[model samples]
Structure formats: C-alpha cells, structure tokens
Target: MRDFTWHVFTQTGDIEAYLLYKEMHNLGAPELGANAGAEDDEGNVADEE
Candidate 1:
C-alpha cells in the first residue's frame, strides 16, 4: 500500500504541481482554450475604453 501510494505520487507530482500553478495563474477565467473577451464584427473590442 505504501509503495503504491509513493509510486502514484512520484508519477503525478509534477503534473499536479503544474495544474495547481495553472489554476493559480488563471485565477479570473476558466481555461477554456479560447478568446474570452468581448469583440466586435470589425475585429475590435467594442467595450474598449
């Protein structure tokens, strides 16, 4: 049991750390892999200040 736990942790530790970092970095928006801001038909942001 102990060895199995250690093996799983060793294999997934880096992936877990990376996922945590990504969650932390992309705090405001979900990582949906697409542009998330408002846009206009002319390819400009309509809400630009």
Candidate 2:
C-alpha cells in the first residue's frame, strides 16, 4: 500500500498525526499479505485468504 517511511519527515510530530498513523497501522495490521511469518518481519499479519 502506502509508504510510511515518507511520513517520518512529513511534520507529523504531533498527537493528531501520531494517532492517525497509529490508527492507520491498526487497521492495516490484518492486511499485511504474505510477509507475516518469519523472524525478519514483525507487526505483520498473514494472507489468510
């Protein structure tokens, strides 16, 4: 989907931006595709389909 590394410099050093990012990630945790397994990746779910 969208790249978050770019947000690191998007002037999101505030509560609103933090929450937005947090919520975005929270909703995205379930759609992480196939990179959900293995020790190399964390925060990743699975391609349950």
Candidate 3:
C-alpha cells in the first residue's frame, strides 16, 4: 500500500492523496526523513548526514 501510494504520487504528483493514504494507514512520514530529521514508526532515529 505504501509503495502503491508513493508510485501514484510520483506518477501524478498528487501529494495530498499520498498523504491521505498514509494517514488512513497510520503510516509514519518516511518522506520527511529525506532531510535527515524524521524518525521511523518505532521511534528509532534514522541515520543523519
């Protein structure tokens, strides 16, 4: 589901729908980690640059 939503977002550039899908599934903000500041669902810190 996450993959599909991300694919949709990539193909259509619809961030709103992608976020809605993530919210529906209680998904963490993985995309936020692109900046090296977001955490995972388990609260583990991701590697920072």
TM-score winner among the candidates?
3
Instruction: State candidate 3's TM-score.
Output: 0.38
**Which portions of model 1 show Cα errors greater than 4 Å?**
1-13, 28-49
Native-structure RMSD, model 3: 8.3
**Taking the tens digit of each residue's C-alpha lDDT, what string does model 2 give over 1-49?**
2234226426555665666666777777433344434643443444432
lDDT of each: 0.48, 0.49, 0.62
Better of 2 and 3 by lDDT: 3
User: When superposed on Cα atoms, how far off is each prediction in RMSD?
Assistant: 11.8, 8.7, 8.3
lDDT of 2: 0.49
C-alpha displacement of 41 in model 3, angstroms?
26
TM-score of each: 0.29, 0.35, 0.38
Instruction: Locate the minimum summed-lDDT window of 10 residues in model 1.
Output: 32-41
Off by over 4 Å in 3: 21-49
What's the count of clashing pairs in each model shown?
A: 0, 0, 0
| Better by TM-score, candidate 3 or 1 | 3
